[model samples]
Each structure stands twice: as structure tokens, then as C-alpha cells.
Target: MEFHWCKRAQRQQGVAIVEFTLALPLLLLTLLAFGELGRMLYQYNSLLQGSRDAARFVASRAWNATLGKVEVSPDLECMTKYVAVYGAPSTPPCSLTGMPANTTVQVTKLAGTNDHVQVTVSYVFSPLIASGLPAFVGNSVALNFPLVATTVMRAL
Candidate 1:
């Protein structure tokens, strides 16, 4: 009985390693997917906050009490874009780390009974794993997606 049990234990010694090797890729992929999701959420939150801040900046500065409407100028638009992208009104737009090159910011002043300023920031999110995922339906779709954040506030 002892001899038979020893033989069985020797045969099963490599089973755990083989199972782990088979599951490792899936486990790593799941972890990477989760991490990518978290990073995307964080970037979206940052973009939203930046839009809000830029909108507030424009609202406070672009208001024209005499005209009864928001005055949006070329310089103001440029500054607003800088604020949304770099968190400040930079003379020469500085590069923000982790911010995509295709990021765009638009500032608009709505004319109505109560004038309001709108700031929109759009960014393209590119996942770390750009390709290699199998698509069962048809063609493999690009993983890149857009993240847009908009904020509107009454001009002060």
C-alpha cells in the first residue's frame, strides 16, 4: 500500500504546475483588463474635473455685465483650451503626461435668457493591449474609444 501511494504522489507532483501554467495567461489577461479599466476611469475623472475648472474660469472671466452676455474671444478660447488640457492658462501649451495628443477642448458661450458658458474636453483612450484579441462576430474592432467631458455654468 505504501509503495502504491508513493507512486501516485510522484505522478501527481506536476499536476499543480501544469494547471497553473494553463491558467496563467487567462489570469494575467483578466488582471490587465481590470487595470486598464481603472486607468480609463481615472483619466475620465481627470478630464471631467478639468472641464469643470475651465468652465468656471471662463464663466468668471468672460462675463460682460454691460452686454448681458458672455464675451468669448479668440484669446479666451485658447486660454480655456490650455486650462482644460494643462490645468492652467499657459502661454505655450505644455504637454500633459498621459494626455493623448488628439485631445481637443472647445469653449462655447450660449446666448439665451441666462447666458452660460460650456467647456468640452474630448480624449481618445488607447488601451495598452492595442490588438490580438479575437473577434467572433466579424472583423476585429479597434479598442480605442473616446472620453468626453462637458461642463456648463452660468457666466458670472
Candidate 2:
């Protein structure tokens, strides 16, 4: 009876080892997914800050230089630096270094008013890990992610 019990214990130990090996990959994947999510969130917030900065710049510029008013001017070069500009959402994400072709900065004076200017910054959001992950997993269809930031400020 004692010998029989020892054999049973040995079998259980082997089973535990096998189970652990099978589960290790899954555990690691979960951890990576969480880390990717955190990174994406941080990027998204940065984009928002970029938009705000662009808007402020537009409002602070010399309106007399562009529209002959006391309002801010819309300068693409300056705005590009403030935000992540992309040509196609995923094709290229925001870059602190340069603005992508898909990235667009539109500055317009309020239709009914002469002093208000609108600054709109649009870019695509790229997932932290999309290549290895299966398709149809994210809220976005693994395509161009729309990240837009807009602000309206009176010309400074």
C-alpha cells in the first residue's frame, strides 16, 4: 500500500509540471497585453496635449500678419511640432521629430465672427502590439485609428 501511494504522488508531481509549462506562455502574453495597453494610453494623452499646444500657438500669433486682424495665425510648421502628424493612421503614428503626410492642420476664422480661430489636429493611433495579435480584437478594426484634437481660442 505504501509503495502504491508513492507512485501516485510521483504522477501528481509530473502532472503539475506539465500544467505549469502549458500555462506559462498564456501568463506571459497577458502581461505583455497589459503593458501594451498602458503604452497606448500614454500616447493618446500626449496627442491631446499636442493639440492644446497647437491651439495656443495659433491664438498667440500676430493676426495682422495673416488675416489682417488681431487674432492668432495658423502656422503648419509650428503646429506640426506641437502634435503628431500622420498621413495614414497606422501607416505612421505621431512623431515628435516630424509630421507625416496624412496629418492635417486646419486653421479657420469663425464663420460669423472675426476674432475667433479654430485649430484642428488629426492623427492616427497605432496599437502598441497589433502585428502579433489576431485581427478583430480591438474596438478599432485594426485599421487607421482616428485621433483628433480641436480647440477654439481668441486671437492673442
Candidate 3:
């Protein structure tokens, strides 16, 4: 019995290209998906760090034990600069880009603990990408990711 393998092999000549052509988009999509995930994590961490910094700042403020609260700025303007300018939440040239629109910095006590300060920084981080689709971060899907970070520390 003679097996004719030539015909089978000849028929598969363009199989590799066909496979690649079909898989290219999937492969690219996966790679881009991972990249976007990383970027999202970075953005979230940045916002988290900003909140932590703000928490520490609020915690360090002079706490009036008698009043049961820290003497903090009523407006909490330092929140934006804290995320943008790093350790220098004070002084000239504060960064405004760090904080997105509707950014809120709420400082509240930990119930029984009058000395504890909790700083919550919330911002709807509409990613630089208009969409969450792969390869093209901005595709047809509109994703408005909400990133919120909160830090609680004892008054120091």
C-alpha cells in the first residue's frame, strides 16, 4: 500500500500564512490587553499614592485634642498638589494636572478615635484611551474607570 503524502503536503503550502493571518489579530489583541492592564494598574497606583500622601499630610496636621479634630484647611486644596508635586504639597508651583475633575478629599475621624485621620481621594480616571479595547486603547467602547484610594493613619 503506497501512501500519497505529496498531495497532502502540497495542499498545506499556505497553511502557515493562513494560520498567522487568522491568529495575528488575536495575538496582537492579547499583547495589547496586557499592556493596557499594566497602564491601568500604574494609573491606579498613582492615584493610590496620591491618597496616601494626602492622608499623611492630613494626619500630620496639628490635632486639637480638645476640639476632637485636626486643624486642616477647610477646602483641602493640598490634595491636587499632593498627587502632582510629590512631597511638596506646600510652597509655589503646585501641580493641578494630578487631580481630575470632581476630585474629592474627605478627612473624617475613625469613629471613636479622634486622633485618627482618614483621607479619601476619589477621581473618575477617564483613561487616556477613549476605550478599553486592545491595540487601540480607544476603540468603540467607552470606559470610565473610577479610581479611589483612601489612607488612614493616626495623628502624629
Candidate 4:
């Protein structure tokens, strides 16, 4: 009986190794997915904060009390874009050190009874792995997506 039990255990000795091998790829893929998700969220948050900061900067400076509207000049527009992208109104060549290349910022001033300033920041998010993968579902679906953050504040 003891000899038979030892033979059965020996046959199963390599089962755990096989199982781990089978699960390794899935585990790695899951970890990659989670890391990508975290990166996306962090980028989105940065964009949102940038948009909000740009909006505030414009609203504080662009308001025209006499005209009853925001007055964003071409220079101000340029500065606002800089603020959104570089967190400052610095002159070029502004270092976009860690930012995505496709990032864009648009500033719009709405003329109405209650004028508002709108700042929009958009960035293209490309996953580390999925960005290079061919779309299996045709052209309708893309692995890369755009993340946009918009902030609207009353001109003051």
C-alpha cells in the first residue's frame, strides 16, 4: 500500500509546475492591464487639473466688466494653451517633458447673459500593449482613445 501511494505522488509531482506555467501568462496580462489602467487614470487626472488651472487663469485675467464678456486675446489664448500643457505661461520651447505628444488645449469664451470661460484639454491615450495590436473588430473599434477634460467657470 505504501509503495503504491509513493508512485501516485511521484506522478503528480510536476503538476504544480505545469499549472503555474499555464497561469503565468494570464497573471502577467492581468498585471499589465492593471498598470495600464493606473497610467490612464493618472494622465486623465493631470489633464483635468491642467484644464482647471488654465480655466481659472483665463477667467481671472480675461474678464471685461464693461463689455460684459470675457476678452481672451490671441496672446492670452497662447498663454492659456501653454498653461494647460506646461502648467505655466512660459515661452517656448516649453518642455513637455512627460506629456503626450498629441495633447491639445482650446480656450473659448462664451458671450451670454452670464459669460463663461471654457478650457478644454485633450490627450490621446495609447496603451502600452494594445496600442500596437491590430484591431480585430475592424475599423469601428480602436485600441487607443482620447481623454478630454473640460472646465467651465464664470468670468470674474
Candidate 3 total steric clashes? 1
Q: What lDDT does the true structure give each of the candidates?
A: 0.86, 0.61, 0.66, 0.85
After superposition, the stretches of candidate 4 with alpha carbons farther than 4 Å from their true spots are 91-101, 111-114, 135-141
Which ranges in model 1 have alpha carbons more than 4 Å from their true place? 91-100, 111-113, 131-138
TM-score order of candidates, top first:
4, 1, 3, 2
State the lDDT of candidate 4 residue by residue for 1-156, as single tens digits: 999999999999999999999999999999999999999999999999999999998898898888877788877888888889888886644443455479988888764545699999999998877656656676545578899999999878
Model 3 steric clash pairs = 131-138
Worst 10 residues of 2 by lDDT: 86-95
Clash pairs (backbone) in predicted model 1: none
Estimate, for each residue in 1-156, the C-alpha lDDT of model 3 and write its tens digit: 135687788888999999999999999878876887788788778778877777776677647777867555543445433633354564434335555455665667666775777777777665553444454544465577677787888887
Q: Compared with the true structure, what per-residue lDDT tens digits does model 2 show for residues 46-126?
A: 666766666666566535655567543224434434433432222223333454665666666667777766767776666
User: lDDT by residue for model 1 over 16-123, one digit each (tens)?
Assistant: 999999999999989999999999999999999999999998898898888877888887788788889888885634333454477988899764645798999999
Measured against the true structure, the TM-scores of the candidates, in listed sequence, are 0.85, 0.64, 0.72, 0.86
Best by TM-score: 4
lDDT of 2 at 126: 64
The lDDT, on a scale of 0 to 1, for candidate 3 is 0.66
Off by more than 4 A, model 3: 1-3, 65-68, 75-87, 92-99, 127-141
Ranking by lDDT: 1, 4, 3, 2
**Considering TM-score, which of the candidate structures 1 and 4 is the better prediction for this target?**
4
Better of 1 and 2 by TM-score: 1
